[model samples]
Target: MDKRKKTSQMQERAMKTMPLGVNSNGRYWGKKVTPYFQRGKGAYVWDVDGNQYIDYRLAFGPVILGYAYDEVDEKVISAIRDGVTPGITSQLELEAAEKIVELCPATEKVRLVNGGSDATQHALRVARAYTGKEKIIKFEGGYHGSYDYVLFSTYAPPSTYGNSRSPITVPASSGIPSALGDLIITLPFNNLEILEATLKRCGNEVAAIITEPMLGNFGCADPLPGFMDGVRRLCDEYGIVWILDEVKTGFRIAKGGAQEKYGYQPDITTYAKALGNGYPVAAYGGKAKIMDIVGQGVTQGGTYAGNAVAAAAAKATLEIMSTQNVHGYIDAMGSRLQNGLRAIFKKAGIPCLLSSMPAIFSVSFGIESNLDAREWAKADASIYKKIAARAFEKGILIDEDPREPFCMSYSHTEKDIDDTLEIFDEIVRTL
Candidate 1:
């Protein structure tokens, strides 16, 4: 096993000042994974103890091109040296917004923000302002962000999530006002009937229906055929705003994202994660008429919203994505990894289901149909967690939480896939 002694020491020291010894709850995820990363490049990360890992976590799906990618980093550095977060907006902000609008068909106008959570919050606020409504509908296990309004039913325990047709609006975090839960409605994902029924009954009260085009936080669950179309139809019929929270799927899935892949257009789209290739940047925008309210009637402001450095990084990342066939490489590599893992599991006589898009995927052990979040919750997660632990021991890195998908980047190669499969083969044989 790789020695994490130095990492452990740092963790001890960090916990004195920082909660859970990490800056973000995601790093620890209420569980312990000992090695701390010092640096990363291409498809690999080196821990503080100098052990290398083939990174499948990819900083929880943000490092699109790679960690510390030269072009993006150079642009960010240049912008910083020139002066970051200037008192006024810079050309970089417009350049970044233009690039995003050019690529994402759903975004006619765009406004920058600091992170995914903020982007989603802004999108919902705009929706409410536009529709003059108070309630919003979110799918169970579809995590938009940590904000109180969208935090309900995300990561809910099965006991709390009452039933499929009408799920209880269970709070994922405490200190969120109990009254906010009443404003938010929770529904089962991938079910058109319940969604249609809910809209028919409470469509007048709902300001928006926000969803991850493909379920990202629970499993990489794709929308069933016509599911997205149905959503669009219902939104149009009810004058309800549709908000696609593409924080995990944007740029990484395709140049145009899930709206392009699934053939449905949302009124508002929230983007982050892959946009700046690990830099903290986000945006929320949609129809020009709706986005007009952002500055005029509704307020959306942040001290670091359109900082030059992040805008430069996003512009550079988008430029690279526009010119190159990044998705082709990601798709090929992800397919290889998925197919290889399937073969390994088959050879080991273990029943498993693999769900994937080109860029993100998940495996549910002992379950052949991982159709929805509830289905994902029913899988033998302990087995995947064990495999993840074994893979970590063998220098392969994936998050132990099975809910997190394996995020493939443009940096991953055939060799990385092969090496990962070899590790999986070894791990499965022992099981």
Candidate 2:
């Protein structure tokens, strides 16, 4: 009997009902490689086959404190005891919103949502309503959500995105209407000259410029020194709303997210992932002037937007973040792991670029610099995929896709980092 016999059998059974035997397309890595996790704890997970792994993916950056963190889970359970959603707002919801307003420098008012997609979708709608414009500008690799308006140019080859000066809008999904693409202007990130030119031409017609502070979905590429400031200035000059999408970088990067770390404020911001420590909770808010438009002819509401469970989870998570040195500890862990990996890759004679912050970063092989998604795409992703696959087999888990980043949790220790480096060195030696 194979060690993965149960996992393989479960996949076969799941394929009978679900598409590709997984709920999310990214979860499918083919029948042979895809794993089914039974449970998770601090910094680790166990597959259905009973194989243990040191998990670095962290469920795509949600389990910031660690999986099943007691502080957050206890709050959630207490809220559940009170009831989940009682058809109206609760005290827990208010506390969560208040915490967000207190921590996030740009967020004066907030509206909780079910997930990242909901937060980004409503942020765009508020921008349109506030500016009285229909068109929006998103970067080539920026992925706001699954919404039709934002599902353009993400995960597509750089060659298909047309010229850098005037890029093409390529739809990421089939069901999204073609007309929605017309409203979106996709531009190459980190190119301030092109952005300035585009804004000069038709910035008035554009309602909002939604962007991730860093290319979270594209190998965690950081913004150039002056690029973010340039965007803020351009948006202000053109009277266009600047929306910072911090779904991945929100709580993981810092207490106040990228806006705090970067020292520039946007008109609006979206947050999720680490807000609830793995619970489905999200929010979008910014200047009071912009968020106030929500009730005035601009609609944004959901039945489960600020439900008790989500609210309690967020409140607890934020409270812990405010009181403790969560970021400090995680930063140390991240720095250690990143330095170890860098040394290992160097010793193996592999040239790699490690991008973004210590908490959430990416490794791009055979590339010296990754300024934007196009440059990031030029890296040898096949090698990364192979490394990730091999790492999984050796009881280490990382995202196989090169675009996704390696997420670190507060639970990760120095021992974990040392062990990971040892395994990576062994794997790199073979390569």
lDDT of each: 0.88, 0.92
Per-candidate TM equals 0.98, 0.99
Question: What is candidate 2's CA lDDT for residue 96?
Answer: 97
Regions of model 1 farther than 4 Å from truth = 29-32
Which ranges of candidate 2 are over 4 A from the true structure? none
Mind giving the per-residue lDDT tens digits that candidate 2 earns over 1-431?
A: 68798999999999999999999998988877799989999999999999999999999999999989999999899889988989888989999999999999989999999999999999999999999998999998888987788988897888798889878899998899998887989999999999899988898899999999899999887889999989999998988999999999998899999988878799999999999999999999999988987888889889898999899999999999999999999999999999999998988889988998999999999899988878887899999989999999999999888899999999998999999999999999998
What TM-score should be assigned to candidate 2?
0.99
What range of 10 consecutive residues in model 2 has the weakest lDDT sum? 369-378
> Candidate 2 has which clashing residue pairs, if any?
none
**C-alpha displacement of 191 in model 2, angstroms?**
0.6
* Model 2 CA lDDT for position 290: 89
